[model samples]
Target: MHATVSDHRSDVAVLHLRGELDADTAGQLSAALAGLLERPVPRIVVDLTGLKFCDSVGLSAFITSKQVISARGGWLSFAGANPFLAQLMETVGLSRYFAIFPEVDDAIAAAQI
Candidate 1:
């Protein structure tokens, strides 16, 4: 998987991810998230529009990042997840932990609030 980050505003960071997020690529996601969390921005929106697949490792990455961000009084959100992945998240009982949006703009706006 590939992770690219951009600043939506002074306080929110947007991470756009593409490709499959599995064991081999989970570390990349983790590192990218870690880098973002290290910055001054406290709100994060992870865009999964281009992501084609995600395994348990990817789920772990998301959960761990949320924990780290929340511990620092930050917030993490998600956007552009496909139906299958969305169902997977709900089935796995992870939907409660994240605010998922249909588009990146919506997520960014919510994070700003």
Candidate 2:
């Protein structure tokens, strides 16, 4: 998987992810996200439109990130996860734990809030 992190605004950062998010790539994502969380950014929007697949490890990464950000008084959200990933999130009962948006604009708006 390929992940790029960009500053969306003053307090919002966007992480654009492409390709599969599995065990191997999940670690990379985690490390990158850890760096983001360590910063002062208050919100992070993960754009998963280009993501092709995700495994349990990826789900763990998302959940862990959410917890860490929440503890830091920030938020972690997802955008454009596609239908399959959406279903998977629901199946795993993680839909309620995250703010999933249909578009990057919506996610950005939420992040700014």
Candidate 3:
């Protein structure tokens, strides 16, 4: 997968992901997200519009990320997840740990608050 990290604002960061997120690419994504946690409270929105597939390892990465971010007093959210991914998240219980938004704008708006 290709992960691009951008600073949305002073307090928010946006991560745009493309392709597939699996064991081979999970480390790349994890490294990308690690850089955004320099601040005191990191608010991140992961844009998954271009993501095609996410394996269990990839899902585990997200769950682990949520734990780390939360422990650091920050928030990690998801945006633009396709219907299948949405259902997968629900099926695997990721929906409980993450606040999924319909789009990047919605997640950004909510994060800003």
Candidate 4:
């Protein structure tokens, strides 16, 4: 997988991910997320529009990120997940843990960083 980050407004960071997020690529996502953790409230919207697949490792990465950021009063949101992936998250009971949006702007707006 590939992770690219951009600032939205002056506070929110958008992390756009592409390809597959699995064990091999989870580290990249973690690294990208780590860069944004320096912010006081680390509001982040993960753009998943380009992401094609995600395995358990991918899920772990997100979980870890949320844990670290939540400790610092930051929040993590996900956007643009495909329908199948959205359902999968719901089925796995992860939807309640993470804020998932149909689009990036929605996540950013909801987070209101």
Candidate 5:
């Protein structure tokens, strides 16, 4: 998987991820998220439209990222998850822990709210 991060605003960081997010790529995601936390941004939005697959490791990375953000009194959300990935998250009872959106704009708006 590949990850790119952009600062949309002073308090929000947008991360665009592409390819598969399995065990091999989960570490990259974790590192990216950790770098984001080092910044002054208070919120994070992960765009997953380009993501084709995700595994348990990927899910763990997401959970870890959320925990990091929450510890800083911030929030982390995901956008553009495909049906398969979405189902996986639901089946794992992680849907409630994350704010999922069908569009990046919606995710950004939700994060700001």
Candidate 6:
């Protein structure tokens, strides 16, 4: 998978991810998210609109990112997940842990609130 980071406003960071999020790309995702946490962004929105697939490794990366953000008193949410990915998260019992939104704007608005 490919990842891009963008600073949105002062306290929020946006991560735009594309391609398949499988084991081969999970490390990159983790590193990218870790780098984002290095700064003091109170909120992070992960945009998965371009993402095609996600595996257990990818899910773990999100979990790790969430843990890091939470430890720093920040929050992380997911946006634009396709139905398949959303189903995977639900099946894995991770939907409750993440603030999943149907749109990026909704995720951002939720974070801002």
For candidate 5, the 10 contiguous residues with the lowest summed lDDT are 33-42
Tens-place lDDT digits, model 5, residues 19-79: 9999888889988888888765358889989999999999988887788778878888888
In candidate 2, what residue range of length 10 has the lowest lDDT sum? 34-43
Q: Residue-wise lDDT of candidate 2 within 1-113, one digit each (tens)?
A: 99999887788888999999999898889887978989763589899999999999999988888887888898888899899999998899888888889998899987545
Model 4 agreement with the true structure over 3-85: per-residue lDDT tens digits: 99999988889999999998899899888988898788888889999999999889988888899889989888889999877
TM-score of each: 0.94, 0.94, 0.94, 0.94, 0.93, 0.94
**Residue 103 miss distance in model 4 (angstroms):** 0.5
Error of 3 at 113 (Å): 2.9
Pairs that clash in candidate 2: none
Q: List the global CA lDDT of all models.
A: 0.88, 0.88, 0.89, 0.89, 0.86, 0.87
What is the lDDT, from 0 to 100, of the residue 40 in candidate 4? 87
Poorly placed runs, candidate 5 (over 4 Å): none
Model 3, poorest ten-residue lDDT window? 33-42
lDDT-superior candidate, 2 or 3: 3
Cα lDDT, model 1, residue 88: 88
Q: Residue 87 deviation, candidate 1, in Å?
A: 0.9
Q: How many pairs of residues collide in model 6?
A: 0
What clash pairs does model 6 have? Answer: none
Worst-scoring 10-residue span by lDDT in model 4 = 104-113
Estimate the overall C-alpha local distance difference test score of candidate 6.
Answer: 0.87
